[model samples]
Target: MTASAVKQGQTTTGHALPILSLAVGTFGIGTGEFAMMGLLPDVARSMDASIPQCGNIVSAYAMGVVVGAPIISLASARMSRKQALILLTLWFAVTNILGTLAHSVGALEFWRFLAGLPHGTLFGGSALTAASLVAEGRRGKAVGHVFAGLTFANVVGAPLASLMGEYLSWRVAYLLVGAIALIAAFMIWRFIPRDDPRPGHSLLGELRAFGRKQIWYVLGVVMLGTGGMFCVYTYVSAALLHVTHVPLWSIPLFQGLWGVGMVVGAYVGASAIDRNPLGATIGAFIWNVVTLSLFAFALPHLWSVTIIIFLLGGTIALGPAMQMRLMAVAGDAQTMAASMNHAAFNLANALGAWVGAFVLASGFGYAATGWAGGGIAIMGLLLFLLSVRGEPRLERSTDSSVRFH
Candidate 1:
C-alpha cells in the first residue's frame, strides 16, 4: 500500500501536506459545529421559531454524532484512510449546505443531523492517519497537530463565521462553512496519495475493542473527567453575568481567551503524552481539580476569574494522552476505539451541562458549578486509578492485540 510508504516517511509528499489537509477538514467541522450556536438566534427569527425550539437542531446534530460514529466505523473499516477522509468531508460539505438552505426548523434539523453523521468518523480517520504517519511513541504529537485545527476554529473560524451571521445572513455564514469543507475535500484529494487498507482488515477485528475493559474505562474517563469542561463552560455566560459581573459586550473576548488557552494546551499536552501518556492523563485531572475548585472562589474578582477560565480551558491537554491510551489498548480495533472518542466527547458535553444545571436548580449558586465540576473530575480520577490499579506503569503497543497494562 502507498499508505505504508507514507507511514514510513519515505513518500515524496511527506507527512505535512496530508496531515494539514486533515487539519483543514477538522477546522471546517469545528467552525460549522460551533458557529451554528452563534447563528441560532438569526435562524430562529427567520423560521419564526423560539430560541428554545431551535436548540433541538443543535441536539439533533449531537445525536447524529452518537448514532453515526460506530456505524460509520464499521462500514468504513476496510477503506483506505485517505478515501475515508475525502468522502466524509464531501458528505459534510453537502449536508451542511443543504441544512443551511432549509426553510423550516424540522427540515433544518434533519439536514443538520445528516451533516453531523460524518463528524466523529472523520476525526477518527484523521487521527489514525496522522498517528500512522509518525513513529509509535510520537503519535500524540501528530494527533495533537490534527486537533489544533479544531482549537484554532474556536479562536478564528467560529468567530469569523459568527460575525458573518451577525452582520450578513445566517445562510451566507453556513454556506461559507460548506465552502471550507469543500476546500478540505479538494485538498485531501490533491495531497493524499492513493492507498489501500491495512492487511487483514475486518469488521470482526474492529468489534474486538468492545470486549476489552480498558476501552470502556478510557471512554468513562473521557465522558466523566473531561465533562467538567462543559459543566463550567455551559454556564459560563450566566456566571459572567451574575457572579463575575462582566459587561455583555466583553463576553466573547473572555471566551476567546479560553480558546487561546486550548491552543497552548494542545501543544503542551502532545509533548507530555509522548513522554508519558499515563502521567499526562493524571496530571491533567489534577490540574482540572485545582482550577475548578479555585473557580468558585475566583468569581468575585475579574482578573482572577479570567485566569481561572483560561486554566480550565487548558485542561484540554488531557485529550491527546487519553486518546493515545485508548489506541494503545484497542489493539486491532483501533478504528472503532478512535471513532468512539468524539462520540464520548459529545456525551460528556451533555452530561456536564446536566450536572451544572442540576446544581443550579438545587439552589447552588453559579459559583457552585465549579465545585460540582471539580467533584466530577475527582470521581473520574478515582475511576481511572481503580481502572489501572495493580497494572504495570506502562502499556505496551508492540502488537495488534489487547494490552492489559
Candidate 2:
C-alpha cells in the first residue's frame, strides 16, 4: 500500500480503523505525559524531594521530547509510517515501565526522560498518517480525531491515574500507562495497513524544512503561547490544595472538568481550522490571555477557579490550528514539521514550568503563574502577527505543493 492508497482506502471504504488505532496510541502517550502532574506530590514524598524539585521531573520529560522529535523523525524517514509508529509504541511502553521501577529522584527523572523519547515522533507519525487518510479539506478534522484521544486521556486516563496515585502509589499510575501503551501497540499492529516506503525521503530534506521562516514563527507561537497553559497546569494540584482549599479527593474531578473542556475545544478548533486556520490560531491565543489573566483573581474562590481551569483547558484548541498551519507551510517535509509541533509544545512545557517555579520560589503566590502565563500569551499573539506579516504568497497559492488541503 502507498500513501495515496491509504487515502483512497479510507475515502472509498469509509473505514476509520487506521485512525482509531492511531488514537489508541495517542491516548497512551497523553496519559503518560500528563499523569505526572497529578502524581507530583506522591512522587515528591517517595523521592524525598520538594515540589519545585518534582517540577524538574516534568521538565526532564519535556526535554526528552524536544531532543527526540527531530532525531526520531529524521532517523525513521525511510521507514513506512506503520513501522515507525509500532517501534515507537514499543519504546514508549518499555520506558514507561522503567519509570515505574525507579527508586530515587534522579533515577525517576532519567526513566521519565526515556519514556518521553518517543512522545513527539509517535504523535507526528500518527498525525501525518491520519491526515493522509482523509480528504485534503478534512485534514484538520482528521488530526483532531487523533488528538481527541489525548483529550480523552485527560478525561478518563489522567483522572483515573491520579485517583490511583492518591489511593495506591505513583508507581501504579506509571504501570497503568504502560499497560495502555501495550494495548495501543497491539491495536496498531492489528489495524493499521502497511504502506510502501516513501520515495526520496531523506534526513537532509527533513532538515531543510526549517529553512522556511514561517515554520520558525509557528514554532515560536507554540513555545510561547502554549507555555502559558503549561505554566498553570504543571502546578494545578499544588494550587488547588494550597490556594483553592480543595479536598485531596476532589483533585481528579477538577482535572476531569478540564479534560471535558479540552474535548469540546478539540472539535470546535478542528472545524474552525478547516474554515480559517490562521484565524483560529490567533483567536485561541487571544482567548488564552483572557482566561489565564482571570486565573489569579479566580484563585480565591473555588467555584470561580474551577470555571477558569475549565476555560484554560479549552485553550488546547490552539493545537490543531497550529498543526494545520505547519502542514500548510511544510511543503514535502510533513513528518518533520508535525513532529516538531510536539517538540515545541514540550519546550513550552519546560519554559512554562521553569518560569512558574521561579515566581513561586521568589515569594510570589501560586496565582502568579497565571500572570506569567497571560504575559506569554501576549507575546505569542505578537509572534503570530509577525508570522502573518511574512506570509509568503506561495503560502496562499493554490499550488498543490504548498496547499494543505
Q: Report clashes for each candidate as comma-separated counts.
A: 0, 0
Question: What RMSD does each model have against the real structure?
Answer: 3.0, 2.2
Candidate 2 has which clashing residue pairs, if any? none
Alpha-carbon runs more than 4 Å astray in model 1: 1-13, 48-50, 197-200, 395-405
**lDDT per residue as tens, model 2, 1-405:** 334654554561363788888988999999999999998889999888886778778889998998999888888888878888999999999999888888888998898888888888899888877777766667788889899999989898899999998889999988989989899899888887777676567678689878988799889999998999988998888898998999999999989998988998888888888777667777888889999999999998998998998898888998888887787778877788889999999999988888888888898899999999999989999988888885544234212454321
Model 2 off-target regions past 4 Å? 1-3, 6-9, 390-399, 402-405
Q: At residue 24, give the lDDT of candidate 1.
A: 93
Residue 359 displacement in candidate 1 (angstroms): 3.1
The alpha-carbon deviation from the true structure for residue 296 of candidate 2, after best TM-score superposition, in angstroms, is 1.2
When summed lDDT is taken over every stretch of 10 residues in candidate 1, the lowest stretch is: 396-405
- lDDT of all predictions: 0.80, 0.85
lDDT of 2: 0.85
